[model samples]
Target: MRAFAALLDALAFAPSPAVQVRLMADYLKRAPDFDRGWALAMLAGGFDTACVRPAALHALAAERVDAEFLRLSLDFVGDPVETAALIWPESGTEPCPPPLAEVAPALSSISRQAAPGLLARWFDRSDLPVRRALAQLAAGRRVPGVTPRLARTALAAAFSADLGAIEEAWHGQAPPYGHLFAWLEGRAPHPEAVAGFRPLMPVCPLDETALASLDPACCRVERQWSGMRVQLVAESGLHRLYSGSGDDVSRLFPEIVAAMEGLAGVFDGVLMAACGPDGPPYRPAPPEALARRLGRKTVPRRLVAEVPVFVRLFDMLFDGGEDIRPLPLRERRARLEARIANRTRLDLSPVLAFEAAEAQDAPLVLKPADAPYLPVGPPWRVRKAPPKTVRALLLAARPGGTGERGPDYSVALLRDGAPVAVGDAPCRLESVERDRLDRWVRAHVTGRYGPVRAVEPALVLEVAFETVRPAPRRKAGLALTRPEIVRILWDLPADAADSVDALNAPVSRPPTAGRASRSLPSGSR
Candidate 1:
């Protein structure tokens, strides 16, 4: 009963079934003559409540927990709490469980009578699940001398408790699945909240200096690839693919859906922009183009053909058989590569061999063979800093039907003389209506025609133009003349000169009598 009471306190404060089973087992073990039957009943009932019956059942099947006790508990407990809990509706269910009124009275009566104090100690009981139900019941309504204690416990959970500590508790005492939700709701604060989500972890703003400071022998690097971040979750033959933002993308990528058939595990990786007839070199589609592909429910056959996506397998959080996140990155990579084997769609991510240096400049590019790899780094190369290009495009400026300045020109990115992603940026107008565009341009285009007015950031356009005529007054060198409208590229990563000296210390080479080579590349080059 002591074990049961403590469980009641724990469940009252933080409900988790994994704890109930383990606690019940502990009770049965410590008290050889304890109520084995009641413990089993609670285990079965509690596991049902927590929606973690499979894991619990597996443990029972394995005899890791006391099966005899759990069996007994299941037979003895006939409480309405167990009945209501058996059918706890999951998210998106049309109707909720029957109104609380029908069952609340029984729960309230039993709980108020069972425990007179707010935090009723149940350490003497073998089955904690029943006591937990009683606590939830007691806290639901005004119980004499009980409400204050329940509120105090809640406050402690909200403020005094450390989330990191609770997460550690999961390894030692709690269930794994609900930790994320519990942390988000503030029942616990998981420091590794971003750790399990593959795509988000890579994109997360981490300190570069800190990353560099880690033991070089163990640390590695890769280009931050440009593509959609996907978290693939599969359990019991059900598959769900979620974007970094948690938006479900199961249907958007049927190829991926088909690819992961019969697979079970939680993993993170990127879907790349497909390339080449025989799959030349895979690269991520520019963010803008990728967005178009991502927004669709059903992609056209032609579109998928034009822009096939492949997976860049990165970190494997789980394998076909085991949870392996606690393993270091190198180990995780090994398991990931071993479990997922489809060269056509899956490629292993390149590792950045760490070197001790004040600074390093490496282009974050991938080998053609490593296309469609997980956690894509930029294709050019992984370096402390990357190169930037400046281009001007000429575009036809027009007002949309809504009276807003439309896009300027479509944009394409060139890295090492090869076309990469396409970009689009539109002219902006404060008011979107046609008259509003005219009025805004008339007011702001201070020059002779003042033909184009700065508008809101919308309607991407393709623009073609020439050199940057430096203007001190303008933020970006304003395009002078209209030319063939190319794709619009705007707001590229804030530009920094790619001079080697800027990113790293210049290496001194012996001066020779030979003249230093110089050549004029094309204007666009």
Candidate 2:
């Protein structure tokens, strides 16, 4: 338990990937096979059981602490493990929790009805470090910087070899793998490659301004769908659906699983739930609902019926016995067309015509008609974003040259033709933009709070932002992440600028199917 706690702690604060790999490898070498296998499984996010649900942990903690306090702590900290470790009652018993190898298996064998009592026993005997480690495991997984790819890298570091062979051997290997250990020590020959889920190639975002340089005839444009990108593998009489990040989400959508049982190959597609039976095809559900289902060990039947899932096939990665990734996208399109015709719940994603002459301002992706699939690099998108600029009325600015560094700014939008405060961020203005901001600040300064200066909300400025989120702290109830002052909109009057409702309305994540798809400029694909 001490060694496991130490590993989790070191990994949580690990400075770099190399250091993370080194720490994990050191522990793996020192711990016995039984203990190390469990640790590996936990770190790689494979050790999920109904025995330790977040609700179960909270229920047990509610017996000792106030329920409202627990909820508040969870909200403020934005982390479950930290909250549990801090708020759980101190135990008087000797710090002698059972071995994790025994504990995880014990928990798995018990019923959900018994989980609360079991969890209480764990919290009662263990210190915060032990509880934190167990809490992380119980709450599914966390980004300790050691992903499966990194885990494979750690294995590679142990034997001083490249990742190709190590990755090939790791496929389908189970935990407490004595065979892998034996092979590493040169007790056996290298393991043969097995057909398993490989990482899917993702579409690259295009460089928007470079469109005129693209050759129209060489590229094809398609509507980038709104769904979770996934890779489906049906090999050796078994099927697996790996999400883009390489996590096996096969069990999350069993309807899709049952649908693909008859097929065998590697497929690339998007997984959507509760979309279309006909009509407009598929209306992609909110990401939050999908996230809820993905995190559960066993999704409830009620939720499954409410949010039935389906896959929209885009490409075929394998055919018969050959790897089709090396073939051109155009070539694979025909294979996908023939293989997935009129399939139930799973159908071909439409390929939009390359409408080059339609609208020059629309975000367009000019993919080479002959582009071969590459998991990394070899970008296919020519430009993937629409116009990012939006009008905002300058409301405040913070002066520069402080020890905390320099200037900051905040802008507002009109609500019913009156100024309504939005969000603010550290000022990011070019030299020319800064000169203009200085004029506005000097002329409009009305009040000051330390470094922040409240200015007359008169000058209309053009601002850009990455995304928006609800802001309980702001009067406007919305704030932007990664906001930057792009340019001064002198031509657009302050009253005629974008309204608070317009800015606050769901902002589109261009190229993806964000909620405001129609109003927002389409991204180039």
lDDT of each: 0.40, 0.68
Q: What TM-scores do the predictions have?
A: 0.39, 0.64
403-513: candidate 2 lDDT, tens digit per residue: 222477888877778877666655444555566668868887999876678987777766676555456557776766556665565555567567766754534222221
How many clashing pairs per prediction, in order? 60, 10
lDDT of 1 by residue, 64-165 (tens): 225564455444654323432232222343322222232233332343233332222221221334434433333331112222223222322433453234
Best by lDDT: 2
Query: Which pairs of residues clash in candidate 2, taking residues 3 or more apart in a chain or in different chains?
Result: 206-382, 206-383, 206-384, 207-382, 207-383, 363-524, 364-524, 364-525, 365-524, 365-525
By summed lDDT, the worst window of 10 consecutive residues in model 2 runs over 511-520
Off by over 4 Å in 1: 1-214, 277-289, 355-384, 387-525
